[model samples]
Structure formats: structure tokens, C-alpha cells
Target: MLQVEHLHKSFADFKAVAGADLTVRQGDLVAVIGPNGAGKTTLFNLITGHLTPDRGRILFKDVDVTGLPAHEICRKGIARSFQIANIFPRLSVFRNVQVSVLSQKKLSHTLFRPAQTLVVEETNRILDSVGLSDKKLDIAGSLSHGDKRVLEIAIALGNEPELLILDEPTAGMSPDETTTTMDLVKRLATEQGLTILFCEHDMDVVFNVATSIMVMQHGQTIIQGRPQEVRQNVTVQEAYLGGA
Candidate 1:
């Protein structure tokens, strides 16, 4: 569903992503695992159109989207969630999701009737999918950290993306919360048939949830294969496992 060929991005004097190539098939759950400065996020930025690649092409479905704007890329059915909780502090959970639904319809005008009334059914369905239906009326800022993470996912789901890019979905959660988040992500991929590409630090989470894994080191792909294949790779062991 997504193809990135010979991608490269540099910042002034440093190369963040160098000659990276990857392909994510429909309904596949792929994990991009690497240490700090491994350029995982940089690759995501380029794919999502937050950063334009200096070289190579980004093809979504079959069309080139290398230089497209972020919103344009999103409209093409790719949605991303940040490593941090990117939620509105003052808005209610319902309102936050309603905004995403409205944006998808190009209804940015706040005065375009009441957004809640306009997209209430659709917003509730999205929130329900992410397991946040009960918290819809709660103030977003008042939710616990774990709940906030779920809310972030809910907001991303509001776009009804074909390919979901989650940046550290389980980043700061407790053990239980991390497990819950992983389960939700798995369901999204397997049941909802959404293709998932995520950058994660937790080895257990990556191995457990990823259908395939790509290991990056020094801004380059070191290994790409199934979990068992990657786990036994000599270079992966030396670079990531041993370091872990």
C-alpha cells in the first residue's frame, strides 16, 4: 500500500535518513525499530509529507506523493499519531475527535452549524473503535496519561485512514496500559484491515505485534524480516539486542 524508494533526507550538514527503502503491504503490521538518532522518525516525516526528501520517491497506492503537503497526504488516506499526546487541553474528548471528522470533510469553519450535531454519530463510532466511547464527555486534559494515549489514537482514527502511522504508541504507559494499547493496535490491523507502520522502542512490543520488523542503525536499514529472522540476525543482535 505504501512504497518508499531510495529515500534520503539531510539537515544542513548531517544526513538523517540515508538511502532508506521500504514497502508496507495492505493490512500488514510493520515495526521500525532503532536506537536514538537512527532516523526512524525522519523516515516517517518524509513519508507523511512533513519533510520533503532530497532524493527518491514516495508512492501511496501507485501515485507519487513525495512533495505533497501533509494535509494532502492525509487526504490520500494516510494518518499519523505523534509520540507525544497531541490533544487539545481545553476541549472535551468528543470535541477533539469532532474536529478531526470535520477536517476530513474540509469543514474547518467553527460556525458551520454545531460540529457535534453534524458529525456526532461518526465521531462516536470512531471513539468507540479506539475504546474511548465512555470518556467522550470528559475534559481531555483531565484524563490519565494512558487514557490520553487512547484519545490520541481515537483522533487519528477519526480520519478513517487506510494506512495508520503510529509513532511510539505505547511510549510512556504502564505495563497494563502498554498491553492494552498493543491489543488495540493489533485489532485495528487484523480486524479493521488497516495497514500499520509504527516506530517503537520496546522490543517485546515490536516482536509481539509486528508482522515484520525493520531495524535501523546509523540512518540506514540494517535488517528487515520476520520477527524470528530479525531476532537471530547477527547484526541486529550486535547493534540492538546486545545494546539493550
Candidate 2:
């Protein structure tokens, strides 16, 4: 569903992404895993238009999306959640997602329409999908850190994206919370048929939920393969897995 080829991006003298290539097929739960400074986030930024690449290509469903503006790319069916929870903390959980649904439907400025009545079902459905329906009326700022992250995912789903990019979807979660979040991710792919690409530092989470894994280091892809293969790779062991 998405293809990134030999992507290179640099900041003056720092090469954040140098020759990174990745391919994510439809219904894929692809995980990008690497140690710190591996440029996983930079590559994601390039693909999602947060950062323009110095050179290379990003193709989504066969169309070149490289260098498109972030909003334009989002309109083209790619939605992302950041490493940090990005949501309207002051808004109710429902309102937070409602805004995204409204934006997606181009109804954010319907002055004559009562915004409360707009996309009610859509917002509720997204909340339900992310297991946040019970918290729909709560203030977003009051949610637990893990639920806040799930709220971010729900907000991304408001875009109805064909490709969902999650940056460290389980970061900062407790053990049980990590399990729950990753389980939600698995269901999104297996049951809902969503194509997902995520970057994570949790080895257990990556190995347990990823259909495939790509390891990166020093701004480049070291290898991409099934989890078992990656776990056993000599270089991966030496570089990041600590020979485990």
C-alpha cells in the first residue's frame, strides 16, 4: 500500500535518513525497529510530509506522494499518530475526534450547522473502535497516559485512512497497557483490514505483533524480514539485540 525508495533527508550536515527503503503491502502490520538515532522517525516524517526529503520517492497506492504538504498527504488517505499524544486536551474525547471527522468531511466551518450534530455516528464509531467509547464524554486531559495515546489513534482513524502510521504506539505504557494497545493494533489489521506501519523500541511488542520487521541503524535500513529472521540475524544481534 506504501513504498519508500532510497529516501534521503539531511539537516545541514546531519543525515537523518540516508538511503532508507521500505515497502508496506495492503493489510500489513509492518514494524520498523531500531535503536536510538536510527532515523525511523525521520523516515516517517518524510513519508507523511512533516519533513520534505532531500531526494527519493514515496508512493502510496502507486501515486508519488513525495514532498506533498502534510495536510495534502493526509487528504490523500495517509494518517499518522505521533510519538507524543496529539489531541485537543481541552476538548471532550468525543469532541476531539469529532473535530477530525469534521475536518475530514470539510464541515469544520459550517457556520449554519450545529457542529454537535455533525458526524456524530462517525465520531462514536471511531471511539468505539479504539475502545474509548466509555470515555467519550470525559475531558481529554483527564485520560490516562495510555488512553491518551489510544485517543490519538482514534483521532487518526477519524481521517478514515487507508494507511495508518503510528510512531511508537506503545511508548511509555505499563506492561498491561502495552499489551492492550498492541492488541488493538493487531485487531485493526486482522479484523478491520487496516494497513499499519509503526516504529517501536519494544522488542517484545515488535516480535509479538509485527507481521514483518525492518531494522534500521545510522540512517539506513540494515535489514527487513519476518520477525523470526530478524531475531536470529547475526548483525541484528550484534548491533541492537545484544546477541539475544
Candidate 3:
């Protein structure tokens, strides 16, 4: 569904991504893992157009999308959630997602029609899928950190993405919250058939849920394979897993 080839990005003398490569197929749940400064997020930025690549090609569904603006890529069926929860803090959970749904449909909530009546079913369905139906009326800022992250994901779903990119989806959460979030991710891929690519620091989370794993080091992908292969590989163990 997505291909990144020999991607490179730099800031001054520091190469954030150097000749990196990644491939994500439809219905596949792929995880990108690396230590700090490994360039996972930079690679994501380049693909999503937050940062254009200094060099390389990005293709989605056989079309060259390199350097496309973020919104254009999003409209092309890519959606993402950030490392930090990005949501409307002051809006109710329902309105938070409603705004996204409205934006996706290119409509604005004018005084003539409150957004409340528009896309009601679609908004509720997204909230329900993310397990936030009960909290729909609650203030977004008042929710727990985990719920806030989930809300961000629900908002991403508003874009009706074919591929979902989650950066550190469970960066800060309780064990239960992590499990809940990962379960949702798995369901999104297996049940809903959404292609997923995520970068996660939690090894257990990556290994447990990912259909494939890509290990990066020094700004390039050193290994991309199944979970078992990554777990046993001596280089991966030494470089990132702390295996002797």
C-alpha cells in the first residue's frame, strides 16, 4: 500500500534519515522500531509531507506521492495520529470527532446549522469503534490520557483512511490502556481491513501485534522481517533489544 525507497532527510550535518526504506502492504500491520535518533519519526514526516525528503521516492497505491502536501496525502487516503494526543481540548468528545468528519466532507458548522445534526451517525460510529461512545458527551480535556489518544485516533478515522499511520500509539499509558489500544489497532487491520504502519518503542507491543517488524538503526532500516526473525537476529538483539 505504501513504499518508501532510499529516503534521505537531513538537518544541517545531521542526517535524520539516510537511505531508509519501508514497504507496507494492504491489510498488513507493520511496526517500525529503533532507538532514539533512529529516524523513525523523521521518515514518517517525510512520507506524510510534514518534512519533504531531501531525496527518495514515496509511492502509494502505485502513484508517486513524493513531496505532496499533507492534506493532499490525507485526501488520498492516508491518516495519522501523532506521538502526542492531538485533539480539541475544549470541545466535547463528540464535537471533536464531529469537526473532523465535517472537515472530511468539506462542510463547516455555520450558525444556520449546528454540526450536531450533520454526520451524526458517522461520528457516532467512529466514536463507538474506538470505545468512546459513552464518553461522547464528556469534555475532551477531562478524559484520561489514554482516552485522549484514542480520541485522536477516532479523529483520524474520520478521514476514512486506507492506510493509518500511528506514531508511538501507546507512548504513555497503563498496561491495560496499552492492551486496549493495541487490540483496537489489530481489529482495524484484521477485521476492518485497514492497512496499518506504526512506530513504537514498546517491544512487547510491537512483537505482539505486528504482522511484520522493521528494525532501524543509524537512520536506515537494518532489518525487516517477521517478529520471530527480528527477535532472534543477533544484530537486532545487540543493537536495540539489549540481548547479549
Using lDDT as the measure, the top candidate is 2
Q: Which stretches of candidate 3 lie over 4 Å from their true place?
A: 110-118
- Per-residue accuracy of model 3 over 130-200 as CA lDDT, tens digit each: 99999999999999999999999999999999999999999889999999999999988888889999999
**TM-score, per-candidate, Cα-based:** 0.95, 0.96, 0.96
* CA lDDT scores, all candidates in order: 0.90, 0.93, 0.92
The clash number for model 3 is: 0
Ten-residue segment with the worst summed lDDT in candidate 1? 108-117
TM-score of 3: 0.96
Single out the weakest 10-residue window by summed lDDT for candidate 2.
108-117
Better of 1 and 2 by lDDT: 2
- Decide which is better by TM-score, 1 or 3: 3
| Residue 136 displacement (Å), model 3 | 0.5
